[model samples]
Target: MSVINKMLQDLEQRQPAQVTASNNSKVPAAASRRSPMYIGMVLLLLLVLLVGFWFSKNQQLQAEPANATNPDAAVRAEPRQPAPKQSEQHSTDQAAPAAIIAALDTTNTAANALSESTTASAVAAPAENAAVNLAAIITAEPAKPTEPTAPAPLVVVAAEEAALSAVARPQASVDKQPLSVAARQHNMQLRANASEAAGDTSAAIVIWQQIVALQPAEAEGYLNLARLWLKQQQIVTASQVLLQARQNGVVNAEINMQLAQLAVRQGQWQQALEFLSDQFELAAEPEYFGFKATVLQQLEQHAAALGWYQRLQQLQPEQGRWSLGAAVASEQLGQPLQAHQYYLHAWQYRQALSVSSHNFIQQRLKATEP
Candidate 1:
């Protein structure tokens, strides 16, 4: 019982101490909050007063110019001489009242003052933002003349006029041939190559046509133009180019080969056969021979195809395609004995044949064996 009474006494003593301590802390906190509120209100009032003062000053400044009763005094007050040397220093000196009035009477001082005031007021903003705002205000300021400078010299004016006249007239005296025909051809070829590299096939085609027109006797230009036409799948246009090239007497083996390939693309086997026949000796390549044999077989000219297949076989004896081609041609020509002999040779040299082709040749051999 004694211990519990002592404990109650201790609790009573600590409660008064805690209450006094809490009250002391609350007093300072309340005072601190009130002080900040008072400071904020005072700052707001100061801002309001500053804004009103600025507005009233601006109005006074504006009215002072209009209310001038004596026009002569206003004229006398204005500086007649243009001070071009002072323009750079005017921005800094414009803060002074006398300098502001003096510069305003002669130049744009009010805008500079406004810009300066805005930059000063925006000090609390970020440095970059402040700089940007200042730049914007300066840019918005009106551009004023530095001075009424002297007029241009007569010699300068004459030179400018002469230059303009020279430009207006064609410069025939600069060079008799600014660009030779050969130079123009080279430039056109470069443009064509650039267009092709950029995948602009139509542009390449147009440039190639220009090259052909520039050099009708140049077989390479005609051949290039024809290839561009073929790339666009314009088979008729390609064929027309070939005919034009032939009429122009631009005889070239490459041009003939291009025509043959173009005719094959258009499925004009007879035209292809004619083109190949003209250039066959010069272009006796294995691919050309195979191409010729295919075209001849498409036209059902088995006898001509048989000769091409024979030539291909001579060129590439181990290739099964030539043997197969010769076998098919002999069968079409109604010579079974020769057909059977060629088919047997094809079976022996059938390394390049696909599985389906192997099956086909086996079936053909069985049919022709009797």
Candidate 2:
């Protein structure tokens, strides 16, 4: 019984030691599993912390620009200017081109009106302020150049008016010779007219003489100078100047008529007839025909005299003298019947004839009727 007991005790002690050893081995395996789990948990916590910090920093960075822009946006908005929309900016950009296109299309009146309105607005708003504010939105426009509100001083207004008148007045009275001969002549004429208006007849005469010197072929200058001489009662001087003008190929009807009158005064009837004959078609005066008829009748040219008398009567239909002259011419041409008819017509307009003409016409009418 003692031996059996000793062996059992020994077995029991060995069993206990073996069990403790197994427990120690199991503890090492469990420690390995627990360490891997702890490492994974710590790595997960670090990744979560890093992700949260990165997210917070990114949010702060994004919010800073917005916070900074707020005050600037408020300031920009204070001017009552609406922020330009993308669509409106594009429309404004197109407005200038549209105005140019409308201006080019002259046939389209409505388009032209629209273009005018658009141009006015563009000039007032965008074109004027474009250099100042690139982001400005176009709106209503001003129409014309701005005028000063307060009335200017009378002296200042008068000065401005005088300046304007000076600018607007013709520069013809200046003594400066223009490059063009025609311009010089015109200026000289204006100067002469001014001198004449100022009662400086001698100055006018001198200027006209200069004009005649510059343009010897110009008839008006000679005529003006001759008329000035005539106005001064210098008939001899007028006659010489007119003759010079005629020799210079300045043969106007008025100059010829003056020459004819002077010749008549000097009793050069033939020379007067020569002057008047050349101007018959050119002149439309009653005295020219009358003078021609009187000269022809005095020279015993009854046939030619009759035609002139007829023309004078046609021109002066209300006068009775031409009828009596026509009757006398017809009687000399041996047409007593025609003379009697003209004599009757002359008697009907006896008031237009002198008393001596009326008595002569009545005696001619009585003799022709018999």
Candidate 3:
């Protein structure tokens, strides 16, 4: 190569390189003379890039957990709060919940407590949980189940039915007979009564008629014979014999009661009322109202019957049976509203009686009531 050619190539390369350096130096000088606003923009861009890098690094640190195990845990498990003192515990100010809501809340609380306790125990004792299977768990849980408390024991009683029976011990009852005038007369009377009871009313009449003729002053014989005939459904004969006996002597009130019952049986209501005029001497009592009302009913005087029953009830307000009986009679007479009022009164008395008595009469009255 010629010395001149080599020098010329080298000069060309050096000139190009020196021109690039001069250009770069001019660019720096131009940049130094830039506006303050443009410089501030560049600085803002640098700050944004640095802030982005810092935020990314913080996110990575937050994702990483302090403890490797139990990553979802919020904090270290703290000891449970101790039971509050009675005074320290606050009473709820709200009104009591409705029965249904109270029951649901109680059930939910119990279920939640049971579930939480089971989870806590499982976490606390892993080896024990593995050792104890379903059978063991069931057996252990039975000792302290979170089931709702049982309701108070039911209070009910079976009421025993009361026994009702009548025992007879009449002083007039005699098994043996004696051979005497009085005994013979009694035997004859007894035979007549037996005949009447056996449906042989005509034979009984004949025996009584003979006895009356034999002893005209014997009022008892005549009256007893009249009663026997009455019992035999011989109403006419009974009335005639009783009329004859009335002249024998003034009979006692007990005999009059018998005559009254006989008259009522024969549908002679007015006569019966008259016969019972002297009944006060035998037995004067409020219970007689029942008999009076019954007589009135038989006489087809339903209103009077109702009045008598009402009077009895008014006299003894606690007599639920009588009150109900009166109500029934009123209803039969087509007085529905009046009967209902009476029934209501009866129910009131029955309630009072139920509270007062160990042996309630309401059950008996219920069967007989309207």
Candidates in order have lDDT scores of: 0.67, 0.67, 0.55
Over the stretch 1-370, how does candidate 1's per-residue lDDT look in tens digits? Answer: 3423443355456546645865877755553344334334334433543453354345335434533654543343334213552363244323333332233223225545644654564443245344533443343332322564446577788999999988966766654667899999999999999999899999999999888888999988887887888788787888898889989987666777678887777777777778875454623466766877788898888998899898778777888889889999998988877888888888898888888889888988987886
- Clashes (candidate 3): 0
Ranking by TM-score: 1, 2, 3
Q: What is the TM-score of each candidate against the true structure?
A: 0.45, 0.42, 0.32
- Error (Å) of candidate 3 at residue 293 is 3.3
The better candidate by lDDT, 2 or 3, is: 2
Writing each residue's lDDT as its tens digit, candidate 3 over 125-192 gives 44432343333333333334365644333222112111111122232345345578677778888988
Segments in model 3 whose C-alpha atoms lie over 4 Å from true places: 1-181, 193-202, 210-220, 227-233, 252-268, 278-289, 295-321, 328-370
Shift of residue 336 alpha carbon in model 1, Å: 3.5
Lowest summed lDDT window (length 10), candidate 2: 135-144
Q: Best candidate, TM-score-wise?
A: 1
